[model samples]
Every structure is written in structure tokens, then in C-alpha cells.
Target: MNVIEMKTPKFLVGIETRTQNSLEIKGEGKIPALWNQFFNFFKIDKKISSDIYAIYSNYESDENGQYDYFIGYEIANPDKYLNGDSYVVKQIEVGTYSVISPINKISENVAYSTWQKIWRMNAKQLGGERLFHTDFEVYTNDKKNGQQSLVNIYLSLKK
Candidate 1:
């Protein structure tokens, strides 16, 4: 695994779909549909960056022990995009983050392992306390032939 520190700028605007429970999480057969919907809705609008993000804003479990998850892409102009009731725009605050890239192919097993490592690492070992407000996963689309893609998980940290 590779860990590094990075200063990220605030995301001015983006479209998102929120899920309250782990069962309804984006990758659990929802992210593909959400991405399709988002692209179809914003077909004419150009994406500001190829950097897609999955933001975890809240981890406080509800009555059912579930957290909140938001999956979306950053946009250059919010005014140009049309909004609907299902698709809401969000503003992400700027912060310093601890970015971790596990040296494994993008798969459910890798994700599970990476997260396990992260959770096992405490604040003292991580060099700061987790903000837990807006941790995100940065998706990279560039993939070589016969190679698996990699995701960089960003954890919000406050010293």
C-alpha cells in the first residue's frame, strides 16, 4: 500500500445520490445505474474533470446501524446543469487528506482488505484524527490493456 498526504481544493459543485444503509450502498448494484442516470441527464454538459469521487459524509449509524454515502463527480459550473429532485448538487469543503492506494487489482476483496487495514490503523498511527466528514475514493479511469484499474481512497485528517 502507498500512503501520502495531499491538499485538496474544495469542490464547488457536483451531482449526487445519497444512500442511508449499507444494503442500498452505491456499488451494491446502484452505482452503475446512478452513473447512467447522471450521464444521461448531463449528456450535453462537459465534465470539469475526469476525477470521479465517492464521498462518505456521515458514518454515524442510524437506528439500523447504517451510514450515509454520496457518489458523484465534480463539475466546473453548477448553473449549467439542470437539477431534479433525485439529483442534488453538493459542495465539498477543502482539506488535507491521507490518500491510500492499496497495491491490488480493483475488486471487492481488495476493497474489503484496504478498508480493514484503514480501520485497524488508529489516529496515532495515521498521524491525525479522522475528520469522518468527507472521506472519499478517487477513481482513476486510465487503465492499460490487460491491467486492472486502481482507486485512491482519501481519508480526511485533522492534526
Candidate 2:
């Protein structure tokens, strides 16, 4: 894990939907379907590039509460994506973040397990209090020969 500061705000252009962890566990997740829509919209996959950004924002409360989740690419321009109705644009404000690459070979179970640890973590364990503002997951397309997923999670922290 590494701690880093985002000196400037970043923008993402993609699709978004609201979801909660508790709802997801109850087989009521909208994220999986949202990803499908993303793939259809972007038409790019691991065979091409898995370099995508998953943004978690608009937190209603903590981890258990509903939040807006977005999956898209970092971009300098938002205007190009504005023409589409399915597309949503977001700006991530400057903040300190803890970067954790929980696993090399990512699976659904392991990824959630990593988050379980984070949810249980307090300020001391996390090295700082959480901002809960704009946590994100970076999906890297580095895996070659196969489609093994990657979990490079970024959690927002206090300055």
C-alpha cells in the first residue's frame, strides 16, 4: 500500500448508477449490469485495454449506504462525451488517498474480502480518517495471455 496526494482534480467520462454494499450482498447489485452497459458503450475489453477507472462518489453515508458508482476513462475533455445520454461526467476533487493493490489475481470473492478489511479498519489502521468523498478502483489491463482481473483500490483519506 502507498499513500499519495492528488494535487489537482481529475475528470472521468463514463456511465454511473447508484448502489450499496448491503444491497449487492443480497443479490441486488446494479453494478454488474452497469459494467455490461459500460462494455457495450466503450466496446473495449481486456483484449484491447483494461485501463479503466471506477469512481465511488456522492456517498449518502458510510460504506453501507448508497453511493454513485462510475466506470470510465480519465480524460482532459468532457465535452466530447456530453452528446450521449447514457454517459455521465464526473470530477474528482483533490485529496489524499491510500493505494492498495490487494491481489494480483483478482476474483469477486477476494476483491470483496479486501474491502471487508477496509470497512473494518479505523483511522489508526488506515493511517488517517477516511474522507468518504471519492474512493475509486483502478482496473489495469496488464494481465497477458488470460483475462485475470486486477484490484487496485484507492481509498480517500484526510489531509
Q: After aligning candidate 2 to the native by TM-score, how far in Å is the CA of 77 from where it should be?
A: 1.2
Best by TM-score: 2
Clashes of each: 0, 0
What is the RMSD of candidate 1?
Answer: 4.2
lDDT per residue (tens digit) for residues 14-128 in model 1: 4455555355443564545666765676443466766667777766643134444555677766665455554556556666577777785677556557766887887776667
Return the top candidate by lDDT.
2
Each model's lDDT: 0.62, 0.80
Instruction: State the lDDT at 8 in candidate 1.
Output: 49
Show model 2 residue runs off by greater than 4 Å. 43-50, 143-148
Give the TM-score comparing model 1 with the true structure, all chains together: 0.68
